[model samples]
Target: MVTIEYIVDLVNKHNVWRGKECINLVASENVMSPLAKRLYVSDFMHRYNEHFEKSHYQGTKYCMEIEGFVKRIFGERFNTDKVEPRPLSGGQANLIVLAALTSPGDTIISVGLTSGAHVSHTKFGVVGVLRLEEKVAVNNEDLTIDVDATARLIREKNPKVIILGRSLVLFPEPIKELREEIGWDIPILYDVAHVFGLIYAGKFQEPFEDGADIITTSTHKTFPGPQGGMIIAKKDFPDKLWEKIYYTTFPGLVYNHHIHRLPALVVTALEMNAYGEEYATQIIKNAKKLAEELYDRGLKVLCADRGFTETHQILVDVRDYGGGAKVAEILEDNNIIVTKVALPWDTPKDATENPSGIRIGVQEMTRYGMKEEHMVTLAEFFDRILNRRENVRREVTVFRKNFQKVHYCFNNI
Candidate 1:
């Protein structure tokens, strides 16, 4: 009995409420630039282009051209020609890589779920889908991967691939040290999904330079593009390996790869090439400031001794404040958006319900022109909501009203 008008109104209501009133701290989401958003809705969305150059249908010359342009831009930025932008999501990117590199029943090493690994790297995701054996690397007291223990595991396990990177990443992974420990033969796949912008801006570790054989990432998280994934390999990677990736990506994984985002992604890459450094630098600063402020307000912020974080994300343990889910709900009611997450101490079972942590990212807010001082105000807002049990939704909405315009983009003056 629902009408189209109702659906349209609901969509419009959500856009205004979330897009305008909320202080979005969700780490996995971002807003595309005006130019990119405009180009996102195009004729390419309705067309079909298949298998890189081999189109399944006609009238795809422009789509092919834009895709090539996107590839070239990513190549130039990342310093590699072996770049693929076709995988539908970051999970699919991981699948394509696993299909290319490992066989069924082959063992692989990755960070465990409670230790910040994306689900795609776990046994329940692409690894299980491909029938691969999953081995977990140990984490240190400070939440970073224990390289020595991981080295021992690598020696004993003889894993087919070693996956680096994490969802709750605070500092750069010890890629160079791990490479030295594991030697050069085994392939190392670094998922740069969370810190793609920092990597691109030269504000974070360069995985390729540190001997990562391949890198997989989504363009949206920190990169501020459309929701899509990309894969890039080192220049010295064997052509045979790239062939495997190509076959896996085309015939093995995606049939009609999303093409509409190419033009939009290109626009975003151009914006990154222009303004990424400043944007990334501010994001890190804001994250650090926010973490420090929250910690100072008596919250158990992780990695405080390590300067809180070197990327956009900040992790806070909220178990004392009614656990993650409750606190996240209360914050959402106050126009603040964050996600409840599992801390390293939680087991997989507890991680699903009543988890101990909340994750906040400042990249989107930074894009909305929030600075370190604004982070202080945000911390006070958190304190008011969680500690004082006060309803500050009106104040939060008023505060957010000043930050509607996007920064670090071509359109913004």
Candidate 2:
């Protein structure tokens, strides 16, 4: 008979293998700081704090204060007095914003899948569910948005909103240039789900400064917070429109907003404020170094002429190593965790299964204190596993053991 301890054992198994042994390169994941993780197991997990301006129930006095404080902290940091922490996930936040801004069957523009747009921005996900028409913006050869082409498209289409930022990110989106070319009538919603922490660190483009009217992001990715979502609007955002977004979040989309993660989220926001710049800088350095090393090792690392990357992510065209699905499986077998994504050449249908590229991120490993030198060793592991057909699980586990501690946070300070 299976006992209750089996589930606990499975949890322990995952913690040991994924937490302590494997080198996690998945672009969309990270570990919370010790303080954040420790505080995560709180009495708040059993409660609810559903509110817009007023609570539907009692016992949320303290939670209200906690949520308000976090909102203010992020507001000041991101140069906005408008920040909504009520959406449970980044996708929900996007849905709330889209729902508030546009009616059903409205037309919007997002970068194509090949250019790194998230599924939530496409017809295969949120757009389809909401009955909105999504048009693809033009992208340049380097996989960055072509500002002139997009400007022409935008003028012709006159879309309701233009969503920026992407999943398989390498370079900054052409926000300022696109805004300048197209004029200011169209609102830009930048999804910084992959680069929230980098933006907070001042290491990437400023969404608001670059003409984004609003931003939707998960606090967990580069932000290193608990698994939750947030939306921030510019200082000059219309009060009426902000009210619409707020209402959409409460009566329209969200309910509890997962008050359990609020304390952890607040702790992570503080942690990001403390060490974000140093952490983001190191993540970029590691990404660039790893990309260069992989390219030098004959891996089809994209955008070598542009120095491979400027953020935590590196996209590798792994078709020669039997496509992204096979390469990701091979890397996982050897204790390296990564996700398969489609290159520009792959059709949308090919993205979900066997795409031509694998996207690697260094932020989590950087949080685990891996640096530029460590990237060389990691590149070697990739080369050995994918190129030489060697199983390096034992080697990866050994290397990972040394960097088990989470860095660039209050855990050390």
Q: Please name the candidate that would achieve the greatest lDDT relative to the true structure.
A: 1
TM per candidate: 0.99, 0.98
lDDT (CA) for every model shown?
0.92, 0.91
Candidate 2 lDDT score at position 299: 97
The residue pairs found clashing in candidate 1 are none
Task: Tell me the lDDT of model 2 at 284.
Answer: 95
Instruction: Return the TM-score for candidate 1, rounded to 2 decimals.
Output: 0.99
Tens-place lDDT digits, model 2, residues 111-186: 9777889889998888878899999999887789888988999999999999998898888888999988998998
Q: Cα deviation of 2 in candidate 2 (Å)?
A: 4.2
Global lDDT of model 1: 0.92
Backbone clashes under 3 angstroms, per model = 0, 0
Q: Model 1, 164-203: lDDT tens per residue?
A: 8889889999989988888898999999999998999899
